[model samples]
Target: MLPFVLSAALLEVVPSGKVPSSIPTASSTATIPTVMITRGQEQTVTPDWSRLSFANLPAITQSGSLNGQKWSAGQPVEKLLTLGDFQDSFKLQDLNLYAIAVATQMPIKLVKLSQFKLLAGQTLADLALAVPELEQLPVSTVKPLSDLLKSAKPSYRLTEKTLPQLLEQDPTLGALSFQNFDLTGYTLDKLPGLIHAPLQAFRHWQEAKLTDIPGLREMPWQQFPNPPSDSSMSGVIQLPTTMSYRLGKDSTSISGSSALGYQIPCAGCTSITFSDPPALQKKRWISGLAQWVQGGISDVAQSTTHSEPTGRNVFGKAFKVVVTEVSPKQAQTALYFRFCQFQQQISCSPYAIGPVPFLSYRNGELMPVGNLEIGTDRSITPQMLPSVKQILPTIPTEIPSTVNHWSELLSQILEQIKALLHPPATPTA
Candidate 1:
């Protein structure tokens, strides 16, 4: 074994170390490769700070780890690395250099991820390249690579038999939007593990369960021994369940078993993004969404004004529409009706037969409204006193001036007449 002086102590401002003194001893050209560090019997100290090419990288070789100290390239490796396709260990910080787009053009490849073996005292974070440009990796290396990265996707297209074990190590991996990935659909077999995992990335992965992946509804799911708490599953804006034993299922729809049901991601996807800085931002979004569903739309509807209602043909001079805030019960019922409408529209469930409401689009969704949104979030901008007279469903309310469905009103009147005409037959005596 030979001991060599590290290059950190050298000041090589003079292009490649090939030229000595204040001037050159060799032709200075960009194509000429400069070796940053040397190993073996040759005691050479060459340092050049000029345009480097991948043609000549560090002089360290695979056989140079003879001392068993896990010797990596010398300090000058950084100057050479920008040239691309490096094949050696790097300080944890330098790992990100591989992401520099210009550097990868060189024929040299980044570290061989397959043969990647950890050196003692080095954690995966040390080799974790934040912006990895590689597309695929060996299956066995996937976990280690996941540990190294704590995430993969958007940068790399990953696929595996399972949902990346790195998910158990760090659920944030699901936060990334993969360009394309061949992964397993969510299953009851895996859900419990994710529910109990400590990492939020696992929870995020669970959130992705809200997706309508094929065959997921058919998976056999029963209450787990350790079901996730409300806090764990809250950020999940919507989830699909063919299982009746869910956290807070609509029991009416869950007869002895669950009828198919699914909720989508929140209206604003940014709240669910993994890149969100605040850990609880996702949770806050769920809370806000629940409030919206429960008719606590907050200040998004305060700008309504002007009450001269006009509609003679369909509505006639029957009623005057008044602007008012929706109560929690009204909001909940509206969402329920909307959900039923969506279910029927998709042809996915058994709908409770009821008269459908006429609809309008106030915020992003179409629901029953009279020139206003029933339950919109704080993010919506309020509308002004424009003459926007949109038609609405025949509302069933106690409001004195409101109109009722003619057919329903006729049925009520007929029942009243029958009761008056046929008083209970005189009690027999």
Candidate 2:
């Protein structure tokens, strides 16, 4: 969704020593908002870079500029262009600025997004004030820019009611991809006739059923649809009934179904994995296909990972954790578990359950260790060596149907166990 800085190898816990206040406690997921510390940070950021055609472009340092504007790292884009500009313009930079430039009949430079807020009657006329070069353009030349800012009844939601009206005013809007459309969540009664439909359009829209869209057929499970063009809207989009993914012809693959009985994007998370890059590299590819779930599209999905154990060892072993997610018919039994040998990343697959291990700070990095043993009373104990037969059956793996509750429970337990494993050293006398 956003660019991530692969600032370090892994997040290491300071074992019973003087810990910097800036570093979070072993139990505290209260993460620093910094991009480098989060899990799958590099994975999250990779898709954005793919939008750029020119490789070897210098990084966006604090001193970077866009079209000669003094844009710096973390600068609020609104200071240069409205959200409308972002959604309509900058969002499509990879396509080159030609279409919008011609539409406005003025110089089309980079810009940034507006939301349903624009459905409230916002226009792009104020753009001249944001970009100094546009100040001298005639109102006539900029008329198309304003025309591009379409609006509907402020009262209309993104539903069957709103779609026809927007199309009635400008049917071409339907041709716009999901990324160009600002609003989401509601499903139209039918697919727009003019939609530039994909062979597998179901993978892109939320709440879409095969019956609702014309000229489509059932997608085979062997195919991995391309990642969604606008993954930022993932957290809000609907998924299909089944999906699958693979990075290459030979990579480890995964497939999942909605009939298994649990919701998707549970707690704004689906799956994660770990990997160790070469010692001198500054960035690494996140090693899982579920990162595609970063866009929140597709149902009946499958994910894949590297088959080999490819990361530094912890506790004399290298391994990876695969969290298998299923679709919801009912609330219980959301995801199952599998233990893949450790590699450089995490992945979510489908089917099966076993002991899910926890990570510990090792050699100045956080590494997955033995499983956390579960008690009959559901108490959790950290085990230096996992006893799968004894621990697996005891796992209260009956994850709650509600996402927030499950997230909260896991957060609380993880913090408690981490605190126990690496207690803060007592203050010096």
Candidate 3:
């Protein structure tokens, strides 16, 4: 049933577009180059069937033009069928070139499948059957394989139902990709038969809300190219206790093991009990205008005051003072001070002078308590110092001043503390 005539004599077809006298032939050991069959203007009527001899052929390539294509091969001659009208169609009974290409591990290029008028319900089934050995197929005509296997290439995307079909047809798919699909509400129960599939690698498995897969008792984790980290899978809640799999991040967790059960004991959680006391709350108090101003003046007086040691050896005690004032303008100030009992010891004090309608502290000099350059030389003497009124002139009376003024004041306070703790080195002689 060969469509073209064949003879024992060799035939030669010239590149000048003329049929030659000799036909090309090759030995079984010789490697065969890829063959391309293109539909020309001369061939208009679609061919119903075709055949291929795979005995000496290593590979073949097929392409469909405006007409038709078909092929078949085997001892009884296994036949392949491609049925498409003007476009492309796949038929189980029709032997087409595309079928031959696939069955022979060759390549086939079809101009258009949709252009051909295909019979109802036959196109998908025929294509599926014809390309049984096809490892890669474009998702243009059908849904991607990712939707079928929960694990596919990282970039696989197909309709929800397509995955089941793919899995049913071929369970040996190795890699799967589902980069950005939201599997929020989908559960493992929706897909019952995937446990037997040969899917080993999965990306974005955590994005799928799969609580448990009872059918999947073990995983072929060794086949995973890049397994997921433990943290990636740790967020998955309520996994089956009997299931066990190694995570990509090098941490292994056994489901039914005592270390990881219904309620895992969190270490270092002694202070993390539910019955712990609530954190302490902070308190704030309000003061009248008179009290506020009075407190401020008292603070100024105490800061300017000084004390001397009593002759009876009762250490000199600096006067303690506090200022809490809220002005008519809503400005406020809170200040506190405490004096040391020892003559040589410095006073420890704190002051919060703000909400000032305008006034801010400035620099001033302190008179030493004693003339001797001993341990108490740095101590200020209240007797020799002027009153708070004298120091007020040196302080700023401006309101809403620059923030730098506050910073400078805080810096001065810090410097004073530092000097008290660690006195400046004596000037090098």
Candidate 4:
């Protein structure tokens, strides 16, 4: 019936008096003696052991002859459990907890451990039925009990009503692992402590501010459909250079009907593919690519008519991207681009990049993917030239930008190619 309180101060609450020679001290080799609690009166004790001070445990029950050895309180609990009668007892979770408490030097009501053993694998409600004092246990005792029972108990479907009371009982439970928890209506201001839960553990938390979640800001942002309210293009990987593109059309020869067409046959235009695309709407890329081109081209005359997703089956599905630039000097340049879902079959082709890492565009530099080589002049065939010439004059001349001559554009492009193909020799002293 001794209370479970384990603190060095618990031993200091002795009746104020002169030191008893019978009681042990710091250097004494005397055996520890127990103090009896008188009915309706307080009992006092003092710590007189070495640095290792623990509560004076209640008297051992059923002493002697444990697994062919004399069982006593002096022996370690682990050895007693390992090679003692408690082997069966150790299997019980409640006893395991009591063993933990005893091992950790936490004061425990040893007499109650047997009762806990009887209720092992049973619910807290079941334990409360027998103990009645279970609810009244102090925080020190309750925490370990909660931890032991956490995995055993059925997952709690927490709601606004139940969450506060559960957290009030033990805030550490906020971090407990729960499968498929949904916090749809919660916000940081409303449940700040809930941040202890992992960001990925809960669902429908898109309502929460992205900045509020730790590590979320650093994740690679993909152009997925139905993004969170705070989602922005700033985090998406930017294409380093607009010059990454090359002019080449679909190489596949198709004789398919338009109504059932799966591939767009552009003999001399740009053909591109986005392999393993993220959950994205075509509009997101269209807007993103337009902004990228405008930003990269300051003297932009006009960027118009990026094609829609046609059932072009070159790789899988394709979208046409057309960017026509008219300079101040009446010279017009156009890029015909085809973007598609890169399929596995494309990998068999000699020109194919093994896997597409990323897709985005910027100004003045080629993209770093393996397949950019497909659109270079090396892939252009004689049949593509007439189609290229036919598409040239049809490009709109309305938009105007600072005009660089064709020769200058070609020279800069060649320099970029030369740098990629042949590195400058390292200077040595």
TM-score of each prediction: 0.17, 0.17, 0.13, 0.19
Kindly list the per-residue Cα lDDT of model 3 for residues 125-244, writing each as its tens digit: 333443443224433333323343334344544543443365465554422322333333333222222122221112222121111221111112111122212221122211111111
Native-vs-model 3 lDDT? 0.21
Give the Å shift of residue 206 in candidate 1.
9.4
Q: Residue-pair clashes per candidate, as listed?
A: 8, 38, 40, 15
Candidate 3 regions exceeding 4 Å error are: 1-94, 99-110, 123-126, 134-429
| Candidate 1 lDDT, 302-355, residue by residue in tens | 211101111100111111111111222211110011010011111111111111
lDDT of 2 by residue, 296-380 (tens): 0012112221011111111111112222221221100111112221123222222121111122122223222111111111111
lDDT of 4 by residue, 161-231 (tens): 33334546666554443122222322222222222232222332222232222222222211111111121
- Highest TM-score: give the candidate number: 4
Query: Considering only N, C-alpha and C atoms within 3 Å, which residue pairs clash in candidate 1?
Result: 15-48, 16-48, 17-47, 85-108, 85-109, 171-201, 171-202, 172-201
Candidate 1 TM-score, C-alpha based: 0.17
Task: For each candidate in turn, give its C-alpha RMSD to the true structure in angstroms.
Answer: 34.0, 23.9, 43.2, 34.6
| Whole-model alpha-carbon lDDT for candidate 4 | 0.23
Error of 3 at 42 (Å): 31
Off by more than 4 A, model 2: 1-125, 129-133, 140-429
With candidate 1 superimposed using the best TM-score fit, by how many Å does residue 12's alpha carbon deviate from the native?
92
Stretches of candidate 1 off by over 4 Å are 1-209, 212-429
For model 1, give the 10-residue run with minimal summed lDDT: 332-341
For model 4 the local lDDT of residue 429 reads 16
